[model samples]
Target: MTDLECRLLVIGGGPGGYVCASRAARMGVDTILVEAGRLGGTCLNIGCIPSKALIHVAALFDTARRQAAGGMQGISVAEPVLDFAAAQEDCAEKVATLRAGVGGLMERSGVKVVQGHAWFRDGKSVEVESETGTLLVRAENVVIATGARPVELPGLPFGGKVLDSAGALALTELPERLAVVGAGYIGLELGTAFARLGSAVTIIEAAARILPQYDDSLTRPVRRRLGDFGIALELNSNVTDWQAREGRLTFQSDGAEQVLETDAVLVTVGRLPNLDGLGVGELALRMTDGFIEIDEHCRTSMRGVYAIGDVTPGEMLAHRAMAQGEIVADIVAGHANGWDRTCVPAVCFTDPEIAVVGLLPGEPSEETVVSQFAFRANGRAVTLGDTEGFVRILARKRDHVILGIQAVGPGVSELVSGFALAIEAGLRVEDIAATIHAHPTLSEALLEAALMQASMANHG
Candidate 1:
């Protein structure tokens, strides 16, 4: 066994681990990051990046198809056929480029990247096993950012015809008909992407509606868009069993049992923290609700041990992990950094994107005033020909301090930054209303909503 020493050792080169290692190394701390897979982790390799790349390609192909069918004004042509293999190749190329970039970033930041599986030897020591040999890394601080994995449902484990998000994304051959079992963001996003590429898609949701986390108003337009896309949605549905021999699924919906034949079934209920092969149980780290218990500083119960990302109980988002990683690194580097944020924004890239920050829409309060501005009234949305949602703002009725911002429509994902900034900086509704917004833009809709809430603009 080869023994090594470092100031910091980050296990799992995911967004959190990589960021923390880079920051710590740049701060003059000798850092080493270990990972069994590619450097970019789930978000960059398979989960978010590749999926969005395919989604964007689907959108482009869909636009061409619709234009060929004369769905748009002053546009007509022949049907555009989808090149599935080519699309797959393109996504792979993009993912590889990004993976290399992540490696380059680590190299420039003076962080050593170890291509191996990492597990705990002790509280502050880690053992890395690669193809060459065993590496024992002892550090002043060890951070676990192993992230999470797909959660499997009983009786329908992932394999064969059943697939998780990663499996679904890597599918080279598009199914003639794909049955997606879940209506959350992952299900809808991938399911919709498949449907756009000419697959007969059916979504089965246990809840009454798709995106049950979001209110009805925010999801209604998405529901309609799904219908327009010819994708079937079975609400309050449950998949009882799968008949692999015949490729049929036995499910119950609306109090009736039915059978749906499909080439593949994608189950995306949720994800669980990646703690299994890391010998975390031996470390005696506390767990909460199936995740690692972490404090504001991402500190575990043990001193000098930090955990972040999906392994922690909180928003299992990349940005959240990244921020937490940065904070942990700063604090370890003798800099003042703590977890402090009013709210974080969430975006769903369905047919029409959804963005939410701060207070939830229609959150109950006697002194709160709520107002909305429809995208139908926005010139940019009209020009884009995809006006199906609105931006709503919640603020104090007395002082007009902005509390929450929610929007669903085309390009609303791009507007999340403005909402995030406004809420994070403690900007008021009046402050937004007083600011001059560029005319004929979707951003103006935000200004209009704020102005309407402040009673400064006459809204119809």
Candidate 2:
């Protein structure tokens, strides 16, 4: 076995691991990152990037089909033929390009990238089994950024007809009938995309409503849009079994057994921390609710050991992990840093996308005021012929301090950063109202919402 030593070792070469290793190395710290797969992890390779590409392609095809059926806005087009194989190839190429970029960045940053599976030997030592041979790595500090994987159902395992999110995305041919076993963001996003791509999509949810995390107001628009796309929603339903041979899915809904004939079944219930086979049992790390516990600086219970991303507690988002990785790198490099961000924005890439940051209506202890601006009244949304949702702001009733901002509409994902900035900067409603917004733009909705909260709304 070969032996190596480093100042810092980051496990799992994902967004968090790579970021930590790259930042620490740039700061003159000896750093090494280990991974068994591609450099970009799930987010860059399979989860986020690939899913978004599929959604974009599906949307393009759906729009073209609509134009072909009935001309919209005086525009007509011939029926668009879908080349599923070509679309998959394009998506794979994009993922490859991004992965190569990540590899190049690591090489330039001087981070020693080890392509292997890392197993913990002790708090400060690890054994990596690569294709070539075994390599023993000893480091002063270790960061566990091993991400999570999709949670499988009890009776239905991931295989031929039954698939997980990753398997669904990796499909070469689109299924004619798709039955998604969850209504969360992952399920909804993929189900919506498949529906647009001409699948008879059916969403099954145990909860009473779709997107239980968001209130009714935000999810209403997406629900309406799903109906418009002819997607069937089976809320308050529980999956019981799946017969792969017959392609039959049985579920319990409203105290009755229901069976669905589908070509594929996608299970996206949730994600569990990928701690198995890592030999975490070798270390006495503190864990809460099956996740590694960490402080503001992402320091674990063991000295010089840190954890970030899905392996640790908090939102399982690429940006959140990136932020934690930066703070941990700073602290490891003798620079003082901690997790002090006010809020982490969340986006649901559904039909009419949902973006939310900071407090909701009743999240604040003090009395709050809510202001809303519908997209139907926004010139840009109206002109685009896709005005289906609204922008809303919540603020302190007495001080007009903006507590939270959320929007559900076309391209709201791009607007969430501004919402996070507003909350992080402690900008009040009056501040947003005073700032001039360009006309004929979707952002004017933000100004209008703030103005309404300030009782000075110029537009409805």
Candidate 3:
């Protein structure tokens, strides 16, 4: 067995792990990163990047179909056909290129990249089992960034016609009738993509509403779009069991035990941290709700050990993980920084995307000022023929301190920076209202919302 020693060792080479390793190595600290699978982990391989690419393709298809149906001048085409194999190949190519780039970065930084399954031997040491043999790694500090996996239900396990987000991304053929088992962000994103690509998609959710975490006003536009697409929604529904027969799957729904015929079932209930095989319990690490508990500096309960990303998370987002990774690297380098940010944005890439920052749960304060402006009033939205959403702002009624910003509209993901900046800088509603916004733009809604917050009758 080979013995390895480093100043910093990061377990699991996902966004969090790779970023921590890269940053520390660049600072001339001896760093080593180990991964059992691809370098980019789930995000690049199966989650965010690939799924967004598919969503973009679906949007383009829908746009083209709408234009053809309207008989718009000079736009002529036959029925749009989806080449699933080509789309999958395109996604794979992009992921491979990114993975190779990550590998190259580690090599250039002199950070050792080990390919194996890592299990903790103790607080400061870990054993990696590789194809050749077991390798021992000892480090002064260790960071666990193993990330998460999709949760599997008891009665309907992943197999044959039933698949998870990862398996769904690898599919080459489109299922004629598809049933998505959850209405969370992942399920809606993938289900919408497939629906736009000509699948009769049905969404089954146990909750009374889709996107229960988001306010009703914010989700109204997306619900309307889903209706326009003929995507059936079964709310407050429970799946009892699923069986595959004759190359098709049938599932039993709640109340009367109705059967639904489906070519494939995509289960996206939620994700849980991948901590089972790491031998963490053996180290006596404190865990809460299946996640490792860590302090602001990403330090675990045990000394010389740290955890970040989805494994020890507030929000399981790639950007959040990246931020935590950078913070941990700084702390490791003796910079004395901790993971503290006022705003971490959450985005959902649906037909009409949703972006939110600094939104808190609870009863609205009596001194809270809320304002909203619809896309129907924006010239740019109307010009794009996609005016079906709105932007809402919440602030302290007394001082107009901007507390939260939520938006649902086309291309709203690109607007998250503005919302985050407002919250981060403690900008008052009057400050945003006084700032002039360009006319004939969707961003005008932001200005209108700000004006409303100021109690000024600017745009009716």
Candidate 4:
């Protein structure tokens, strides 16, 4: 085993690890990052980047199909064929490119990266098993950002017929019939994409409604889009087991049993933190439930060992992990830093897309006031022919301070930054209402929503 020492050691080069390593190295701290797979981790390699790429491809393909059905506004074209292999190749290329960029940044920043699985040797040290050999690494500070993996159904294990998000993304051919096991963001996003790609998609949700975690107002348009696509939704359903031999899903819905035969089954129930290989249980670290318990400073119970991202608690968003990574790096480098986040934005890349920040809709708060501006009334949405959803703002009735912003419409995901910034900066309804939003733009919806909230009148 080769013995090495560094000022900081980060495990799993996901958004959290790589960011921490790079930032610490730039601060002149001797940092070493150990990763078993690619540097960009789940979000870059398989989760966020690749999924969004596929969604974009599916969207274009759907547009072509729509145009072919009955040319939109006099534009006529033949039906488009999706070359599935080529699309997968494109996603792979993008993932590879982004991963290589992350690798280059870590190298140029002087953070040493080791390709291996790291197991804890102690609170201050970890032993890595690499292709070259074994490595014994010790550091003054360590951060674990191993991230999470897709949750597989108990009865329908992942293998030939059942697929997790990664498996779904790696399809060589688009399935004619796709059975999605959940209706959360991951499932809905992929299921909707495949449906657009010409697959007869069936979404089986254990909850009573699709996107049960989100409010009805935010999810109503999404549900309407699914219905428009003729996508089958079996709500209040549970997959009992999968007959892998027969390629059928045996599920229970209503009172009796049911069977759904499909070309492929995509499961996106949830994610469990990647903890099996880390040997965290032996390190005497404080854990909550299954995740490592960390404070505002991202400090674990074990001294010198910090846990961030999916390995810790809170929202498992890539950007959140990145923010925590940067904060942890600064904190370790003798700079004062903590998890000072105002909003961790949640975006669902479903049809029309849904982006939310800050307080949830109908959240029990006496001081919060809610107002919405429908896209049907917005000129930009009407011109674009996407006037299906609306933009809503929740602010304090007492002070008019913006508490949360939620919207569902075309390109709302792109408008998430503006919403998050308003809340994070403690901007008021007057602040947004006073700003001059560009005419014939979707963001005008936000300004209008704010205006309507302040005056209690329509922005017509």
Candidate 5:
């Protein structure tokens, strides 16, 4: 057994863990990061990065297919053939390149990367079972950045034809008829990609509508686009059973039983915090809703121990984890910091992307004025030939201080940062209205929405 010591030890080499370790180490704190898998964790290895790459490929193929069917804007092309294996290989290459970049960043930042599975020996000590031998690490401060895993359905377990988001990304061959058993972002994203790639995709959602977290208005365009892509949606449905031998999935919907003959089923209902086999039980750490509870500074109940990322509360997003990691790193490096950010933006890369930040419509507010600017009216969107959605801004009725901003349109994901910045800067509707946004750009829609809220819309 080899024993080591550090001022800071991060238990998972994900976005949160690696960020915390590297940032702290650069600040002159001795830090060590341990992981059982790739350095980038789920987001890089199997989740966000690979998924987006697949989505991009799907979009390209879809555009080509459309052009072949009938030329768009005088652009014509032959019916595109999809090489699934090559697409997968490209995604793999992207992940590997990013993974290597992350490793380089850690090395340059002076973070020691230990490849192993680590478990708590005590509050300040951890024992890692590495391939070479048993290694023990003692640290003054520890951050639990162990991320979450995909939640599986009760009856239809993951394996064989049943796949989680990770398993779906690693598929050797795309299923001809795919049944995705969730309507959340993950399900919709993958389902849309497969459909674009020529798979007959059916999305089954237990909720009443797709993207149940968002309001009907924001998701309506997405729903319409799904139909345009020839994908089926089964809302308000519950999967009862799956027969592997018969390739049949049984579900109950609206007091009726239905069956779907699918080549494979991808279940992505949700994700649970990954706390299994970590021996956290021995530490007796406090947990809330099955996740490690932490304060604004990401400090857990245990002294010198902290938690971040999906293992803790808040949205399970890579950017959120990175922000929290920055705060923890600053605090550990003898500076003072806490979570005081105004909002965390969320983006869904659907047919028409959805991006939102700050408060929604129904959230507790004192007399809010909601205003919207349709992309159809925006010159840039009209020129782009995809004007199917709108941007809505919610603000305080009296002061017009922007409370929330929600958008559903083409490439709205790129506009989210500016929306977040506006809220963080406490910009009122008047402020956005007065700002000069570039003409013939999607960002002009934000200004126009604010102008509408301010009752001075120029191009609404």
Candidate 6:
């Protein structure tokens, strides 16, 4: 058995783990990062990046289809045909490129990359089973960034035509009819992509509305887009069972069990921490709901051990995990930084991409003024011929402090930085309204929303 020693040993080479390992190595800490699977983990290899690529392709195809339908001048083209094999190939290539980039980063940072499954021998020691042989690593600090996996439906067996998000992304054949379970961001984003790609998409949600976590006003634009796609939405519905026959999937819904012949069924319910075979119970670490409990500094209950990313708690966004990774690196380097931020932005790549920052879950205060500026009013949106949503701002009535900024429109994802900055800096509504946004642009809606809150409209 080979033996190795390091100052920091990171398990899982996902977003959080890789970032933490690289940062630690740069900070002069001897770091070793071990991964049982691909270096980029789920987000890069399967989840965020690949999904965004598919969304972009679908967006382009949809735009072309719209141009053909509208008979726009100088926009003549044959009906858009989706090459599912090409799309899957493109996703695979992007994942491979990103995986190589991550490997290069590890090498450049002087972080040793170990390919194996690591099991804890103690708080400061790990035993790994590698292809070459067994190896033991002794370290002063350990970071568990094992990340998460998709939650499987209990009764509905996932095989054949029934698939999870990862499997759904890998399909080379576009199903004529697609049934998606769960209406969360994952389901909506992919379902919208598939719908744009000419699949008859139906979303079944146990909740009363899609994106139940988001405010109704914020989700209104998405609902409208869903209608535009002719995508069936069965809200307040549950999937009792699913069976596959002759390359078709049949599912039962609530109340009257109507059957729809589906070429594929995509499941996007949720994700749970990936703690299988990690032997966390053997250590003195505490767990909350199957996730390792960690403090703001990312320290686990056991001394010299820490946890971050989806394996910990809070939001399961990739950026959140990256932020935690940075904080953990800082803490390991004896810095005083912690995971404390006023706002964390989230984006959904639906038809009218939804971006939100610093939004409180409940109703706005009575004194808190809220305002909206529709994309229909924006000259850029008019020129693009894709006016579908609006930008909304919420602020305190007393001090005019910005409470939250939310937008549902084309290219809203690119505008999220400004929203996050406004909330993070505690900027007043007037400050945003006073800023000179360029004329005839999508960003003008942001300025308009802010201006509307101040009871003044430069351009209504």
Ranking by lDDT: 2, 5, 4, 1, 6, 3
Please write out the lDDT profile of model 6 over residues 1-460, one tens digit for every residue: 9999998999999999999999989998899999999998899988999999999888888878877786564586777777889988988898899899999999999999999999988888899999999999999999999999988887666777788888888888888989999999999999999999899999988888899988898898899999898899988777766656654434455566666667888989999999998888779988889989988798989999999999987889888888999998888877788867888899998878999998653666457878888999899999988888989888888998998888998999999999999998999988998899998889999999888877687778
The digit string of per-residue lDDT tens for model 1 on 350-451 reads: 989999898875564647888889998888998988789999998877777788899999999999989999998889998998889887788988999988
Candidate 5: deviation at residue 306, Å? 0.1
> lDDT at 103 for candidate 4?
86
> lDDT tens string, model 3, 95-150?
78888998898888788999999998888889999888999999999999999999
Task: Give the TM-scores of the predictions, in the order they appear.
Answer: 0.98, 0.99, 0.96, 0.98, 0.99, 0.96
Ten contiguous residues with the weakest lDDT in model 2: 451-460
Which residue pairs come into collision in candidate 6?
none
Whole-model lDDT, candidate 5?
A: 0.93
lDDT of each: 0.90, 0.94, 0.87, 0.90, 0.93, 0.88
lDDT of 3 at 115: 93
Per-model root-mean-square deviation over C-alphas: 1.2, 0.8, 1.8, 1.1, 0.8, 1.8
What is the lDDT, from 0 to 100, of the residue 356 in candidate 3? Answer: 92
Candidate 1: worst 10 consecutive residues by lDDT?
451-460
Q: What tens-digit string does per-residue lDDT give for candidate 5 at 76-109?
A: 9988899999999999999999999999999999
Better of 3 and 5 by lDDT: 5
Q: Indicate the worst ten consecutive residues by lDDT in candidate 4.
A: 451-460
